[model samples]
Target: MPHIHVRHYPRNFTEEQLRAIDEAVTAAVTSTFATGEDTVSISLEPVTPEDWDSQVLAEIAARRDELIKAPGYWNES
Candidate 1:
């Protein structure tokens, strides 16, 4: 059960865009894990710049070791 959660800056993503994102993630997850497509779930979170540090960065710091991919543009300011 691989649940993919993507956090990004706020943007108005349309249904088509969302579907495209979900499909791409599903393909990757299924191919990598050799699992059924139905088992893969995807969610997108829009994090504003003002709240990124407190909300997203805190979680990233707490789960640093568990992150498969880490953000490269991290700034303390």
Candidate 2:
């Protein structure tokens, strides 16, 4: 089974947007993986508006010292 995870912000997305995303995922799997839409599993997660930006900021802050001190930490292949 092929699993696809789609994450979206909570505030601005509409039903049409969600439908489009689902369609796109189905199309992508069918085209690229040669899989039927029924076999493609999708999970959609929406983050709360208040928690989203704060979570991102916290992650950046936690990594800030390493980011500033060692460019290799971020640029490693």
lDDT of each: 0.89, 0.70
The candidate that wins on TM-score is 1
**TM-score per candidate, in order?**
0.86, 0.54
What are the per-residue Cα lDDT tens digits for candidate 2 across 38-57?
Answer: 89888877767678546644
> Which stretch of 10 consecutive residues in model 1 shows the poorest summed lDDT?
68-77
Error of 2 at 41 (Å): 1.8
C-alpha RMSD of each candidate structure in angstroms:
2.0, 7.8
Find the candidate with the highest lDDT and give its number.
Answer: 1
Off by over 4 Å in 1: 75-77
Query: Candidate 1 lDDT, tens digit per residue, 12-53?
Result: 999999899988899999999999999999888999999998
Alpha carbon lDDT at 44, candidate 2: 78
**lDDT accuracy of residue 73 in candidate 1:** 79
